[model samples]
Target: MSTVQRALAVGLGAALLQVLMVIAFAWPAADIAPRDLPLAVAGPQAGAVAGTLAAADPNAFEIITVTDAAAARTAITNREVYGAIVTGDGPPRMLVASGASPAVAQQLTRIGQQLSGVPVARAEDVVPADTDDPRGIAFGVMVLPLVMAGIAAGVLLTVVIPTVGGAVLGLVTFGVVGGLLSMTIVQGWLSVLPGPYPVLAAVAGLVSFAVAGSVAGLAAVFGRVGLGVAALTMLLIGNPLSAATSAPELLPQPWGAIGQLLPPGAAASLLRSVAFFDGAAAAAPLTVLAGWAVAALALFGIAALRGARTEVAAPAEDPLPVG
Candidate 1:
């Protein structure tokens, strides 16, 4: 085969792979419907309501029977459930947390309205998205640029610095800059994410660190290919799997579980916890980020040590002869 033909084949193959990945990550989400989506039910008629909803569409909701409307409301605010149905003598009331996932909230509301054998009185948003970005798209999508910046920083720092200390310095510097910049755009300028500014900035910083560390570690081990791998893992798989546009349970099967385990997914979940749930569910995701950062740091050390040993073993070039 000619060199030119081989190159063309490789390029086309790469392009096709990218296209397929995009379709795999995005196309299915276009016409999203509930799939074991968490929902709470309250009052005496809760069992009947759950039974009716289940009978209609068995896969639509994962119902949790709560004692009362107060408990149901608590579940929504804590982000324990996406929405709730409250059954009483009068019309049934639907409560939801739009802040957790606006799409899920809307879906639950629709389901509540269409529920058979009982009239749905009203659908209320217990927790809504920030005023500036009511739809919450910005909150989810903005993480893309932040992750990209982290990846770039990781690769560049590893290439230029080479030493573990220098790499640490680079990571810290980039993380602070990225975090502050992100906080400014989301909170200061747009007011899409509400203060406390310091808390938001800290969350951003952690995300930056986790992403940067992972990329740098990969690059240290695999060179250029590492960067591409990191990009694919974080952006292509992590972003859509994170369920930023919806809830994790709404995602298809194991992809949802896998997404939550990745850095991008963990970061997104942590931010949501801080922003809407008052940091109630922050512990688990925070631990996930910390674990990634620590593991990457270890990788960085190994690479640095290996490079140093190679330098020590290599024969020195003969000094130029002086006249």
Candidate 2:
């Protein structure tokens, strides 16, 4: 084969490989929905009522009995329960935590209207998210930053150094920078986000590492162009498809399903729990993120180490009869 033909074939093969890698990560042709969500019930009398309500709508709201209304509200504040139903002698009130999910509040209102034939008053304890921070929506900002950082790491590897060297640098970067970011978050350096300090720190660290590792892995599998594919994976396909700004419940058919497997989707869900809710429901999301990161890192490490091109030494002709 001609030199140009060989080069073209290798390049095309690398490009296709990168695309497949992305598809494997971002595509989830499976189901994605919450089976149970934590819900605190305030009044003892509310047990039957809330239980009945939940039974009627088995898909959402897992009712957990709290001693009193105050306690229930506190649970919501601490991000334990998504919200509560506080029943008093006067009238049963729905305590909605807008921060956890404003869409839930809307759903509750609709349900209330259906049940009572009148609009039941709602007490919003946890308010809706800030309008200013685009990133804060569904913890997308937090996840996006890390994914972008990872793609950047991949680029640095392919462009500035050998694939193996670049991957090593990416791993180190994830470890060092991620740890430092975690410390800052734990120390309460940023006030815009109101979740637990430790949770933020841990999440930031893990996410950073995941992004970096994924990028490195892609670089190892492909080449310089692999960086582009990684960007498409984490940014264009992952971010846009992820229900970060829009709740999965509200999204359209394909995008909603597609979003579930993306790093942003997985990480954002976990982060929301850490930041806005008690860690009770974060296990699944955390596990998903961990799995992806670990898988990417393992594959990258193996390929970068093993699939290396051997250094070719030029043959020297014997000095013709030692002139």
Candidate 3:
């Protein structure tokens, strides 16, 4: 085969591999596990009652029974947990942190409705969401772009041994694109999503940065397989489980349960809080994103340095084995 033909074939193969990797990673994260959400419950037999309730709905909460309403309220303010539930003869009241988890917010609503016989009312001590922000919609906005950037970074870095540098380049590209589309084109053609252009731009940049760093870092570790990690992180696992189109409460138990751990899900919750809600909006999400970025950078840095040292040390031994 001609050199040009071989090059073309190799490029196509790499592209195909990347695409498949993305599909594999980005699919099947429809299930959301509740994991460790802090919750406050109050009732006469709060301990046994909360434990039983938690056992019944493990996917819904990490239950903690508070001493009283005042303690519940205090717990929420201090950011000790995401939501609270109080049981009484007449009805039940749930305290939800609107900014923390849209899924949790939705879950409170559904739980309120399901407690038949008893009346349930949601209390508003926590900060409320914006009239404009749709809790779940935030995921699609920031996550989609981030996932794309990650996929691109993974592919570009796979063929090159110093995948870290290539991955950084990919992140830079995403940031640029996000700035242009979300910021510069505020009034352009992106009216499809609604919201101020500035807000969108800021979100876009953050998402881009996170996705790029994550994808690049993963690729540095796994080589071609890193594409799958990136895809799973942003597209499949993160996006579907994210509180994008629907709140966790809105989804079935599994999706709601696992949603918080995903990046898009976390960011989606944060964006909704920043745009419309007020409670603990920035703290958790900022920490999550910063954590992701830091971890990615660390991994990429270590792997990259090791790879460079290896190449320099080994330096290729004789390649003259032709017929």
Error of 2 at 119 (Å): 5.4
lDDT score for residue 84 of model 3: 75
**TM values, all candidates:** 0.90, 0.63, 0.58
Residue 302 accuracy (lDDT) in model 1: 88
Residue-pair clashes per prediction, in order, are 0, 2, 12
Best lDDT goes to which candidate? 1
Off by over 4 Å in 2: 1-91, 106-120, 124-142, 163-166, 182-190, 196-198, 224-226, 253-258, 308-323
lDDT of each: 0.82, 0.63, 0.62
> Whole-model lDDT, candidate 2?
0.63
Instruction: Tell me the spans in candidate 1 whose CA falls farther than 4 Å from its real position.
Output: 1-3, 116-121, 311-323
Locate the minimum summed-lDDT window of 10 residues in model 3: 185-194
Q: Which number leads on TM-score?
A: 1
Ranking by TM-score: 1, 2, 3
Error of 2 at 194 (Å): 2.6
